[model samples]
Target: MRDLVRQGWTITAEETAALSPYIRAHITRFGAYATDVPGIEPEAFDPALDEIDFTVLDLAA
Candidate 1:
């Protein structure tokens, strides 16, 4: 997840900062992808499905 965030995977700066803590909490409890993350809905991850109301984040260079 950290690598994905660093590689610019449609996440915000604030969201990027929060990933580590979220990952830590999740790891301590259940571990990686244990629960649904807030803001990023489940459907947003589906490559085959198109979403009409999604904002595309500019990937960092």
Candidate 2:
């Protein structure tokens, strides 16, 4: 999270609006966690989500 802040990411008003309800209902129910990612807007965040590549680890192997 700190790294994201250093990278210039900020949670936008639109992103807050889009995520607030779900976050409140689901995430908060579990416990508090930081969801703030500064610098990018909601629209930008959606496209950025697609660009992420996750490396799969075969833990069972």
Candidate 3:
């Protein structure tokens, strides 16, 4: 659309710089395609605690 506008109007660097990449109006008209996945969430990892052995070790003195 910028290119289309650029054909008629002379957009300067300042005007172009003001443009947003977060412009969502163009795609919002298409509506949303939603998906839900249950019981697929990953558990958080704790390397130090998870890797430790809870069992006691008896050592010779």
The clash numbers for all candidates, in the given order, read 0, 5, 0
Model 1 lDDT tens row, 1-61: 6788788887677876775544444344744564555776554555654655345454432
- Per-residue CA lDDT of candidate 2, range 1-61, in tens? 4677789999667866775434444355766755786665555334455555555445535
- Each candidate structure's TM-score, on Cα atoms with residue i matched to residue i, is 0.19, 0.22, 0.33
lDDT tens per residue, model 3, 1-61: 5776768877678987988888566577666755676657778876778666666545422
lDDT of each: 0.59, 0.60, 0.70
Model 3's lDDT to the true fold? 0.70
Least accurate 10 contiguous residues by lDDT in model 1: 52-61
Between candidates 1 and 2, the one scoring higher on TM-score is: 2
Give the candidates in order of lDDT, highest first.
Answer: 3, 2, 1
On a 0 to 1 TM-score scale, where does candidate 1 land against the true structure? 0.19
Clash pairs, candidate 3, are none
Give the local distance difference test score of model 2: 0.60
The superposed Cα distance between candidate 1 and the true structure at residue 31, in angstroms, equals 19
Candidate number with greatest TM-score = 3
Which regions of candidate 3 deviate over 4 angstroms?
Answer: 25-61
